[model samples]
Target chain A: MIDFKQEQDGAVLYVDDEQNNINSFRSTFRKEFKVYSAINAVEALKNLKSYPDIKVIISDQRMPDVTGVEFFEKIRHIYPNKVRVILTGYSDIKAVIDAINKGQVYRYIDKPWNNDLVRLAIQDAMDLFDTRKNLSDKNESLQSAYNELDKFVYSVSHDLRSPLMSILGIANLAEVDVQDPKSLEYFQTIKGMVDKLDGYIHQIIDHYKGSQGKQFGDRIDFNKVVDEIIESIKYHPSAQGVKFQVNLEQSDSFLSNKMNVKTILSNLISNAFKYQREEETNKFVEVTGTITSEKAEIIVKDNGVGIKEDKKEEVFNMFYRAKQDETGTGLGLFIVSEAIEKLAGSIDLRSTFGKGTEIKLILPGTSE
Target chain B: MSDKLSIVIVDDNEIDLMIGERLLSRVDQSIALTKFNHSTEMLNWLQREDENSFTTNTIFLVDIYMPIFNGYYVAEQITQVFDAFDKKAIIYLVSATIEISDNRKLMLNSRVEGYIGKPVTVSLFKELIKKHG
Candidate 1:
């Protein structure tokens, strides 16, 4: 959607008190650029306003009404983006210093200037202008594309869930009516598959929401948020018989996007529930959250099945599931990492295979 | 008979309508049920009723996405009609959308009492009945 590589033939404006100098400058660079000649500062200002695309503004230092530095300084606010150059035969050090400091002149060429040198300087200015414009245009289009993708992800996931819900609901209704042991088992299988599909859909939605970028603020209640997340996960099938301990310490009010924190916490907590070692009788997940004036720190530790030493680094990669478990979407930790990065934070994970895992996250307490 | 709560369900999708009807019946069989495939038809039915005819407690569960008039517009029209006759009714918005920001503006309207995501279930329907029925 962006044309960053396309070449641009930018315009140049020459301002001078003498018509002969303006004519000669135009004749020398007319083929390379579209040249506009102005007889004085008044006319130059008018042209600058009318033609905003004029990339270079070259003016003679000596003029009847105003010096080149004065003219450049005057138009700095009006056409700040334009590249400015001064032409003067008189070696006035004050004028040169003023032009450099106040006027923000890019370069200065002596009167009876070398045509080749002036031409090169103008070319360089145009290139710089084109590069800046191209970068900004590309950024705008990229931002818009991301926005569209977010909307598409939301709608598609939402629509997909509709039919899946219908299937699940119908199965649920049928399960209630079925009496035969074999038939009931069949219905239970259907319910299991539907629930798995529903979980996958929810993960997809959460992945998109996590990547939507920078939806954080100053009003966050960590205690209440943790309570809600624990409540929801406690009801899940995988969380059966798993114990949770939450400890929150905050002397100052925490400020960040509550949703992002919720996502990160929920994913980590859910993973703790999902990957528990079945044989291990003592299974527990501990979360400690501390908030200071500058930062909010959270550490989630789970005593269950842990990641292999070789797969530690790759765990954060998108769709990189370490285990062959059918329930793992591999997007859970990836979303966690993304949300942390967006919050201008960092995450450190330590784990011992077959023992336990602990994840530490430190995020900015205030919006940057 | 007039004391029974009336439930009005509107959805363009046939399968969704059938599933919703089944779910509502599963929740409470005695609820007087009315179904509409089009939001315009639903609006018209409400507008055509006599001024004092709204005696029983009524609840509307309208899908947010539809062809002609959306659930938001239907909710606004219902609010106006009911307000003119000094009546009270509950309106709930239903959508399959996971994007919370999409329906945020509609959710702000005073006429809308709640928002429900699909597919409609007996438990959710039972909760709705207990809260509004």
Candidate 2:
């Protein structure tokens, strides 16, 4: 249901070889629209070039120099947004088909056209044109906003890390010269605080980068990815003494964004290592991945402290932590969820309170 | 082979320079340590030194983020001088920033031997010296 009255304000161009037909068209729709009349295709092109606001172009099929379809095809690239309509005196089904396929005409008008039908067609065309313009403008603004945010994140993180690094450096130097045990303990505490801050800053950087949704399609080797992540995180104090079992079943490589997969695995594995029961001696984390032609599935199961059933739903939300773990920033799972969503994946959690937790993820084999 | 090791550290932050000096001194008390808060000053000093001064094994730790001349530029300049002087210089890029892309770009350069994250620890310093010394 188009607002015909509002759409009537849009400019319409009428191209006809006969002066009488052009005059009659102008006389009929002149009150309803800002009508611009052209006696031939050449004149119509000139009018189109001069008036950028013309939303619709109506041309007669049988013309002296060129047919209406030919004119529409020629100007389609230049004025793509302008909706085209065909007018003919005969039934010419072949010409109408050609017009629809080649010229992309909105509608074909018969010789004795109903004024109301033609007005409705023009209104619809104008509405479509306005909708397209609004969408494109919105997309442009959103892209610019995203780019600004990216630059802001990059610069802000760099500035914040600069002074923090200086503090860490000074602390490191001081630690070496201090002989008193208490003073050394204080320096160690300072170092720990700085390391925690550094970890938080890294998470912020990762979150911003992951949210950009820029996908880099590359061949994924799950074995290599899991091994690298384990190697990197194995040295963390929290990961100490936790046995890791990796089983990659897919022999063939899959295609996906490597960074996204890395982030997902890193966050999940780190969490699996972090939320362990101190009293449990048989602590083990198992990562298993399988890829078929259609999709890839990864399952991470840990025999450690598990999540409470009631609070499981809230774990994916930003800054949502189940326990009073000061070291956990609550951003890890949120970032993991975002990465999975961007990859067109779904995650399911199965956990028994004080027993264990297991997460299974299914992702599309290829990105859209 | 009796030539002692020479260490040159260029960073814009005064605190970082002091830290680096202390760290290097702790690594080896007798090793020659030169610290510059500005890249241009380091470049000027290097230019003034005689050719024989670079005959000894030397290591340069350049901070990537600076006001004018960045670590990449300094590393490139050092490589150029090394090529002219026909000597090998081990140039390591150090930065507090966590931008992996920037670090990757720096590592791709043939002149850059390695990239170290900021707040250099004693163990890291010892490992680098042993591996590259």
Candidates in order, TM-scores: namely: 0.84, 0.85
- lDDT of every predicted structure (CA atoms): 0.80, 0.83
Q: Which sections of candidate 2 miss by over 4 Å?
A: A1-10, A91-93, A214-218, A255-257, A295-297, A341-348, A362-364, B1-5, B30-58, B102-104
Chain B, candidate 1: TM-score:
0.88
- Across residues A209-260, which tens digit of lDDT does each residue of candidate 2 receive? 7876566566788888888989988889988999889987985668777778
Please give the lDDT score at residue A137 for candidate 1. Answer: 92
Worst 10 residues of 1 chain A by lDDT: A1-10
| Model 1 C-alpha lDDT per residue in residues B1-133, reported as the tens digit of each score | 3353777889887778887787777677888788999988888898899766664567888898888898888888888887876556788888877655756767667878878887777787788778766
Could you say which candidate leads in TM-score?
2
Give a tens-digit lDDT track for model 2, residues B1-133.
3254678899998988888888878887766777899999988887787668864567899998888898888898888788777566888898887874775777666878888888878887788668756
Clashes of 2: 0
Worst 10 residues of 2 chain A by lDDT: A1-10
